[model samples]
Target: MIYNTLSGRIEEFKPLEEGVVKLYTCGPTVYDYAHIGNFRSYVAEDLLKRFLKFLGYRVIHVMNITDVDDKTIAGARAEGISLKGFTAKYEKAFFEDIETLRLDKADYYPKATEHVEDMIKIIQGLLEKGYAYEKEGSIYFRISSFPEYGKLSKIKKEELKAGIRIDADEYEKEDVRDFALWKAKKPGEPSWPAPFGEGRPGWHIECSAMSMKYLGPTIDIHARGVDNIFPHHENEIAQSEAYTGKQFVRYWFHVQHLIVNGEKMSKSKGNFYTLRDLLSMGFSPRAIRYLLLTTHYRKVLNFTFDALYQATASLKRITDFLFELETRNFSDGQTEEARNMIEKTKKDFTAALLDDLNISGAIAAIFEMIHWGNKAMEGEKLKKKDAEQIKLLFYDLDRVLAILPEKIIEELPDEIMELIKKREEARKNRDFATADAIRDELFKKGIILEDTKEGTRWKIIKT
Candidate 1:
């Protein structure tokens, strides 16, 4: 069951029609590299899509890139590049980093620059309905015209005036609560011809226009970071619903911030780090994903190097166990006791994932299954069919874990293979000390060598 933040309740997720989900996620501004805090939202959304696919739903996901914004203009000016060149550079990097993190690609990645006409049409509609007005050369949405302006944020309309911050010279409006729909063309800045004038769309309006252009006036879900709840998403709700005279989104999902060392990560404070930066520091991509899944999506995740180390160790153990299981030759079938244990494990794991995507509980269930599988494998007189059933159980649980399956078959370098051979020879000669020394050498190189009843196996230790 999916939880809808708009209603503040959990409901059986029935699509607008049957068998399709229309989802939208707020994408990056493309001014710089996205830090880890930004990825928490992407990871949360990826998990949502994965779970939905596991439950047999076809999803059409759309995310927009804010290529033309205040930040993009300022960054382009600093780098002496055109706005097009600046946004393109960062957008490419964003895709590469997300691929490294193993995030599923969106069905459509719309850019703000490509949808200027759609945004102009929406603004024109608002102006015709007296919900928007032009001040000087810019267009602003009149907040007072929309009676349910604060419904999504639950902020009272009377208290919203003081929360708005507008420049006095920009306009002499009656209310300080108005937000911009379009900014008039400025000198040496990117602009295009529109019905209103020569200018560009505002940050908030771009999302509503792009989403509605691709997914219609209403969608199944709209997701963003929690920091966007107050002004950005609230403005989107106000503008879209007022223009279409219908609901904006059915479910509103937001992910909490990722804190580092008890404080929020910020670029000005020099505490910000990107996914590439973490990888250069020897953190594995799997370890990063593992650390992200340890906390719930709605809760703040406090990340530290120590926590990453623990994740690395935990992943290594699971990988080692799976590697051992795959090498054993076995046939298909199961004893009564082994079949019951596998069924119980599968039931527990599915139940945990069904309840609001409880990933932590699901991980605990995986470890329990691993424990039982190991014990079953250790029996002296195990049936071939029973051994195959145990291996299949691990594979089934991995559909959600996404950590163990990748580690089952490892690629070893020639040097590592030579060391393993040397260690094996020493062990056969009864030279225990020399064999232990060779094992330590492999550990120093981030390779773990394991000895099982089947044979010798090795895997890359996530550091």
Candidate 2:
């Protein structure tokens, strides 16, 4: 259950205030559709929240949308649309993608554009504290003032570069190391009026301002992709700690990047795959989520068609087993072996998740449960009540796994329903030949029929 913090590894966790967890996750800068790589971070965050709830902690998760950033401004201009319109389009897409992934909804979804006043007030505080200075037409955080600038990323101060701005602007600051707090007014760019001037907030400043505004100066956890460790998160730490003079976050959890062919997935690489792309290719969203959970959150997940196919097959096996268990009968009394196995699996799964959300290990524990359940069923050693108990145990495990239970009773059209009823009646009358002919007729129409202890089930087979 140890968590690695930027300061050091912590073996124990004590909430800042009992029973309350304030979590801040760096959300997408909505300019375009989010790729699968982006979804990986969201999935990791979702799991963290779920695990926290499992541990009896009340979590207040807040994810801020960078509705106005350099990228958003550029995108709006390029598309000849208003900043509001551009951000709305991409934000909707991001929400839809994550919703399909079944990631838990954040308690608060704050947008940067809506928090300009907060950003301005924070910048004002930094200015009053001498941690920030106004440059030509912009406000920049004086990196030298914050002695611990490189602490979060562990980058040495001597090796740091100046003016490493992500924006494509011609205005260069006198010091390249000084990052922006506020960008001076520019034509064709979104702006808000403040004491400094009419300008927009910087990329890194938005999160610090919005997070602290909602979740106090210090939060329980702050999470983002590992790529944001430098510059983005580093700057956030510097600005937030400087303004508040307190710890910004107790635990900083970062999920590793999703790679394709050993290269990071990015828009610049032109090799990124969006969730929509996978869906269009006939991959189920559940299978995509399964593929993600199979790998540890901190490990680099290398995605490929083969990996996805394997995940699909594994998910199908679990679903089929659950379907069978639904119809089987078992006695109420628990077997010692089964009880011990369940307790061990739960312990291992919790330990893995607690250790920086080691999802791969937790998934392996789930497979062990599946194996035990399968064996118990095959030997008929499990009474009807015992089998029911196993099924209930799996449902508890699936709270974090988020996989839906398999449907035992397949849906049928009115015509197909009538055919199945006729076939069943014929079988009851001992007319085997007629029943066989009807089954063959249904099979020709892309339906595969199966009879279980409960009743008959049919599946539509896609060609």
Per candidate, the number of residue pairs that clash is 0, 11
Local accuracy by lDDT, each model: 0.83, 0.84
lDDT of 2 at 256: 83
Worst 10 residues of 1 by lDDT: 398-407
- Cα deviation at 247, candidate 1, in Å, is 0.6
Each prediction's RMSD over C-alphas, in Å, is: 2.1, 3.1
Model 1: per-residue Cα lDDT over 229-328, one tens digit each: 8789889998999899989998888888999988889878777889989999989888897888668888899988899899988887777666656676
Q: Which structure among the candidates has the greatest lDDT?
A: 2
lDDT of 2 at 170: 29
Off by over 4 Å in 1: 329-333, 380-397, 405-407
